[model samples]
Target chain A: MSNDNIIYPSVHSFSNLSLSDSSRTGFGYNPYKGPSSNAITPETSNILINKKTVSLTPTSFDSIYDRNILKKVPEISLSSFSFLFCEIVNWTRNNSKGIQDLEQRLNTLGYQIGQRFLELVKTRERIKYSKREIKILEILQFIHGAFWKSIFGKTANELEKSQDIENEYMIIDDIPLVSKFISVPKDYGNLSCSAFTAGIIEGALDSACFPATVTAHSVPKEGLPLRTVFLIKFDESLYTRENLRFN
Target chain B: MTLHSFYIFDRHCRCVYSREYTQGSDGGSTNRSNESDTAKLMFGMLYSLKNIASKLGDKEARNNLKSLSTGKFRLHLFETATGLRFVIVSDPAIDNLQSVLWELYSNYYVRNVAQNALSPVDFACDELLANPKFVSETDRFLSSLPVFR
Candidate 1:
C-alpha cells in the first residue's frame, strides 16, 4: 500500500522518454524538432501504440465542457438504488461481528468515496475559487448546503449550533438519501444506517484539514420518521486555533 | 372498487407500518390482536416468496416480486434498494396501482416519513398515520383516482 503513493508516468511523459537517442527506435520521425516547451503541442501529444505512433491534433478532441461534464444532471432510478443499498447493508451485516463493526466497515467505504468526491467537486467549481475554507463555520456551511446538494440533490434541511456546547454543531437532513429505504431491525439497538453518511462527512472534513468526529443519530418526529441528525464534534485544537485566529 | 389496506416492512420481515382504509368495524380488542397476527403472517409469506423467486433464477437478476393476485384482491409490492417493502392490497381488477405505489413511495413516504428529522429508526409509523397533512394529501390522491369513485 505504501508503494501506491509513487507517481506513475503519464502518457505526456512519454515524450521525454523518446528524447534520448539510445532509447529511440530511429524510425525516421524526428523527436527533437518539435516544440521543446512543456505545453501540449501537436507533436508531443502523439501516443505510441505497439510499434506505431499516432499523432493527434488538438482539434481531434471535443471541448472539455462538451465531452466531460453534462449540461443536465443524470437521474438514477430510486427503486433500483434502494435494492442495491439493501444488499450492501445485508452484505456488511453478514461479514461484521457486531453493529459497531458493521458501522465501521460502512464508514470506511464511505470515507474513501467522500475523499474522492471532495476533490471532484472542488475541481468542478474551480471557477469560483476565491479562498479555501479557513473559518470553521464557513467550511461547515459549505458541507451542509453545497456539498449535500451536490451529492443528495437537495440542501440539508437545517444547520444549527448546540445551545450549551461551543464546539458542537448539528446538520439535520429531513430524509437521508442513503438510508431512505433502510430499516434497522430491533435487535440492532440504536444503529442508524446514516452512519455511512456521517463517515462521508467526516472524510470530507478531515481532507479539508478541519479534523472532526461525525455521527448520525435518529431523531424521530411526529410526521417525519426517517429524519436524521448528524452531530459534528471538532477536535479541541481546532477550537483553540479558531479562537486564536478569529478572536 | 375499494382500496383495502397498506403494509410497510423492513428488511428483517418485521411489519413497521400497517393501515386499513375500508374494513368494516368489528369493534373489539380482538381485532387489534388479529390485525397484528395477520401482519406478521403476511410479512412471513412475502419473505418466503422472495426467497423462492430468487432461487428460481440467477440471484443477482432476481428483482423484488412486484405483485400477486388471489382472485379476490391484488397485492402490489414495491421494494426499495435498502430492502424496505411497501405492499398495497386493493380490488383484483384495479389498474395503474403501480403508479399509485410510486406516488405513495415518492410523494408520501419520502416526503413525510423519510424526510422528518424527528422520525426514529422504527419510522414513527403511528405519527405518520396521524399527521393531518399526510392523511389529507393521501386521501385527496386516492379520491382523485377514477377507480376510487
Candidate 2:
C-alpha cells in the first residue's frame, strides 16, 4: 500500500499510456499445418546435400586399349618366376602370426595390389573394359571376363548372389590354377595366393570409385575346373544411396 | 677346300658355304676322307674371316662350331657380333656345347642382367650395409686391422 502511494514514473512507466487497436495480416500463412510439418527433417536435408548424384554417360570401350602400349622385351620362361613366387609365399607365411591372422594379413596385402591392378587391367584390355561408375553386375562381369582371362587364362565359373542376403555376391572360379600345385600344410592354413587375386579385384573396384569389400574363399569343384569363389559385399549405405538416387 | 659345317654369327644369319674344292689327292679315304675334307674346307673358309674381324676390334664375339664324325672332331672358327673369333674343336661337338654357351652368354647378356638387377637381393644387401649390425661388424673389423694401427 505504501509503494502504491509513491507512484514513481520509473517504476510504472506505462501508467499514462493510452490503449491502441491492432490487426493481424493472415497472408502467406497456412493455419491448418502443424509445427512438425514445417520443421526440416534429416531425410530431406540428406537428399538436398550429401547424396552422390552423378550422370552416367556411356562411352565406348576403345579408350582403355588406346592407353595400353605393350613394349616387348626378350622372351622369359615361366620357370624363371616360379622360385621367386614360391619364396614370396614362404616369406609371407613365415611372418604371419596365426592362421586366421595370416589370412587377414594376406588379405590386407592383397588390398593395395588390387587397387593397382584395377588401373592396369582397365588400361591393358583391348575390348569390353569399363571406365564409368560401374554397377556391381558389370564389375563382376569385367572381373570374370577380362581380368580372369588375362591372369588365369580363363573366366570364372559363376557369378551369383546369396539367396538370403541382398548385399552378398559370389564369383565362383572352378579351380584356382595358381593354388593347383600348392598344398598348404596344416600350419600354414592362412597362406593363400588367392588373396593376391582378391586384392586385385578390390583395388580395381576402389580405383573405379565403386566402394565394395571382397574376400576369396577356396571351394574345390568336383570334376569341373578352377574352383574358388570371391565373395563381394557392398556396404548397406552404398546400396541405400544408390537406391535413393536411382529411384 | 670344300666347307661342311659353319658357325652362325647372329640368331638369324645363315652359314656361308663355297663349292670351290681344293686340289688335294689323298685318295679321299685315308685320314683325308670326304667328311674330313668338307670340315677342313669349312675351317679354311672361316679362319680368314675370323682373322679379318679380329683386326677390326671386337665388334662381335667369336663363335666356334665343332663337327664330329667317327668320334673325331674338327675346328671351324668364325666371328660372332664381336671380332674375337673362336676355333671350334670337334671334341665336344657344337650341339652339346651350344646350349651351355648360349645359357652362359644369356646370363651376361645385357637384358637378363638388367632384369635381375632390381631384385630383392640388391635391395636387401644395400639395406643390410646401411643397418647397424653390418656397420658394427665393419667397425670391429676396421678397428682390429693393422692399417688402423
Candidate 3:
C-alpha cells in the first residue's frame, strides 16, 4: 500500500447507534448525507458501543477557530530585535564551516518562518474575494507589494524580469531589514546576511507552488551601498506548465 | 558652519577613515604634514578628553563626550556601543552635530563598511579605507548637508 491517502472515520455521534446492530461488517458512515443515501453497512459494533474511555477536550474537534490569527501585529522595539539578530549571526558564525555554509545555514533558519508568514499574510489580506494566486506574475506582484510592506513596512525597491534568461527575475532592496545592523568581517568573502531574506522569498514562492531558487547578492550603487539583489530562478517545469495552461 | 573634515577610529584607537575637505584643517584649512602622525595625535587627544569628560560625571552612567570647541573649529564626537568612534571637524559656529553623526553611523558607515563582506572589520596599522563606493557615498551624503562647504 502506498499510504498516499488514509481517510480516518469521522467521530460524529457515538450514542446514536442502537444495541441491536452488533452483526455489522464493512463499516462506513457519513452523517452529513440523508438516510436515503446512507451506506448503512454492517459496521463493527465496537465504535457504536459507548465505552466512555475517550473524552474529547473542549479544544479538540468543535472549536477550530484560532483567536490569535486575526489579531493585529503588535509593535516591537527595533533595538531589541537588532540585538537579537546580531547575536544569532554571531552564534552562527562561530560554528559555520565557511562563508557560503554560514549563509546557507542562515537561509535555512528563515525558510520555515517565511512559509508560515506567507499563509498568514494571504489570510489577513484578502477579506472579501479571497483567492489563491496561481498565475506567476500575479503572485510576484502580491509578494512585491503587500507582502513586502507587511514585513519591512515598505515595498521592495525594484522588481525586474531578467532580459537574458527566460525564467529569471530580480527584486532589489536598499538596506535589507535583517542585515541593517550587521557588519561582516573582511575575511568572510562576499557573505551577505540577506541570505535569510532570500530564503524567505524562496520559501514563500515554494509554498505558493511557484517553486523557485533564490539567492541574495550585494550590488552596491553610487549612493546605496547596502543595495542587495535577490535573484529568483524558477524551475523549468513551471514554465512548461504555465505555457501549457495560460498561453 | 563649514564642514572641514571627517574621521573614523576603530575600537583600538586607530584611524580607519580620514577625509579632509579643505586640504588642511588644523587651523581652519591651514596646516598639512605627515597624515598618519596627525591622525595618531588626534586620536590620542580625543581618547584622553573622553576619559576626562566621562570622569567628571556620574561614574556608573556611560557619559559620552559630545563635542570640543576652539576659536577656529570644533570636533564633534559620536561613539557607538561597539567602541567605534566618528569625529567630524567643522567651524566652531556650528550647532550640536550629535544627530548628524548618528545619521552617519546608521545610514552610511553601518550600511557600507559593516554590511560589505569584502570590507575588513579589522584595519591594518596605518591602513585607511579605500572602498570607492563608501567614499563616494559619504561624500554625496555630506555634500548635500547644509553645513558641508
Candidate 4:
C-alpha cells in the first residue's frame, strides 16, 4: 500500500499441484493474490450517519478502505464467514419484530458490505481508464459479472430482466454460498438467509448510483435445493431519468 | 533512524490506538498527556488537510495524500475503505513507513483485534482498541523494525 510501484498479485495462478484436482485441468486454483481485505465488519452502519468527529482517540483497528482498498486481502473461509453470518443473523433476529424485520436487518448488514465492495472491486479491476457504469443494463451486467465474482468467487448463474414487470430484474444463483449450510427452521415458515446477499446486491447497486431494492427468494429447481433468486426492483424515477439523460 | 510514534483512527476521526516509543529521559505524566493532546490535534489537522489536499490536484493529485513532513519528522498516513486511518511518525530521512503501517494493520491489528469475535468490532466510535495482545505484539513488531531506535 505504500508505493504505487508495488506490484499487486493477480488471482488464479497455476502453482502448488494439489493431489486433489480442483478443476478439469487437474490443477488447484492458487491465486497469487492475498485474502479478502474485508474480513472485519460489524462496525459499519447501514445508513451514513454523520459521525460528529473531533473527539475520542483511535484504538488499534482497521477497515477496508483507502490504501487497502485495492490490496487483495487474505481469503476469508466460507465456513468462517458462514459462522459469522449465522451469528449476525442470530443477533439481528433477537431485535427483529418479525420475519420481514429480520430479513430487513440482515439486508441492512449486507448493505454496507455492498457499498464498500463496489468501490474496492472496481478499483481492483484496475482498467487503467475504466469509467463508472452509467447505463442501467451495463451496471447490472457489471454487478452480475465482476461484483458477484469478487464477493462469491463466481458470477451469478443468470441475469435476466423480468418478463412480466418492466423495472424488475432477476439474478439467479444455482447454489447460493451464504445459505449453503443454513436451513430455515420449520417454525420460521419461509425465512431465507439469502436476504443478506440480497442486501449486498442492493447496497452495491445503490452505492454505484443505480438505486434499486433487491430481495432474495428461494426458487428451488429439480436438483438445486439452495437455489436463490435475487429480485432487483429499480426506483420508478430512474427509468424516467435515464430516458431524459441518456436517451 | 528513529520511529517516534504511531496512531490509528477510525472514520469518526477518533484515535483508536496510539503508541509512543519514548526511551529513558523523555519521561513524565504531564508530557504523556501533552503527547496525547498533540495526537488529537494532529488528527484534526490531518483530517482537514486530507480534505484540502484532495482538492489541490489537477487531474490526479486528488485523493492521494500519502505523507507529510517537516524538519523534525515525517508523518505517513494510510486510510482504509471503511475510513480507518493509520499514521506513523518517523525520521524525516526515512523513505516511507506506509508499508510498515499496513503490515501492522493487516498482521497484528486485524488478527488480534478486529477479527477477534470477543473483541469489539467498532474500533471507531464506540470502542477503544485496548487489546493486550494487539498492543504488546504491536510494540514488539514496531520495535523490531529497522527504522526503530
Q: lDDT of each prediction vs. the true structure?
A: 0.70, 0.49, 0.75, 0.73
- What tens digits encode model 1's per-residue C-alpha lDDT throughout A1-247? 2433322323221223333432222223322333342444454344222233342355645645456652456888886776666667778888999989988888877777777777767766666745778888999888887788888889999999999998899999988997666655446788888888988988888777677888889998988888999999988778876888799
Evaluated on CA atoms against the true complex, candidate 4 attains a DockQ of: 0.01
**Largest TM-score belongs to which candidate?**
3
Which whole-number lDDT from 0 to 100 does residue A129 have in model 4?
Answer: 21
Arrange candidates, best lDDT first. Answer: 3, 4, 1, 2
For all candidates, the clash counts are 17, 24, 3, 22
Q: Give the TM-score, chain B only, in order for the candidates.
A: 0.78, 0.23, 0.86, 0.84
Worst 10 residues of 2 chain A by lDDT: A21-30
Please provide, for model 1 over B1-149, each residue's C-alpha lDDT reduced to its tens digit, 9 standing for 90 to 100.
36777777766556666666654453111113223777878778888988888888786786668888887988888888878888877888875477788888788877655543323445343332334345556666766778774
Ten-residue region with minimum lDDT total, candidate 2 chain B: B12-21
Q: Give the CAPRI rating of model 1.
A: incorrect
Segments in model 4 whose C-alpha atoms lie over 4 Å from true places:
A1-69, B1-149
Q: Can you tell me which runs of candidate 2 are displaced by over 4 Å?
A: A1-76, A189-191, A224-226, B1-149
lDDT of 2: 0.49
Write down the TM-score of every candidate: 0.53, 0.43, 0.57, 0.47
Residue-level lDDT tens digits of model 4 in A115-188? 88888888889683289877889898998998888888899999999999999999999998887656564567
TM-score of chain B of 3: 0.86
lDDT of 3 by residue, B25-137 (tens): 43232112225687789889989988897888898998888899999999999999999999888899898999999999998776676655445567777666766567777
Listing candidates in order, what is each one's chain A TM-score? 0.72, 0.63, 0.73, 0.73
Return the TM-score for candidate 4, rounded to 2 decimals: 0.47
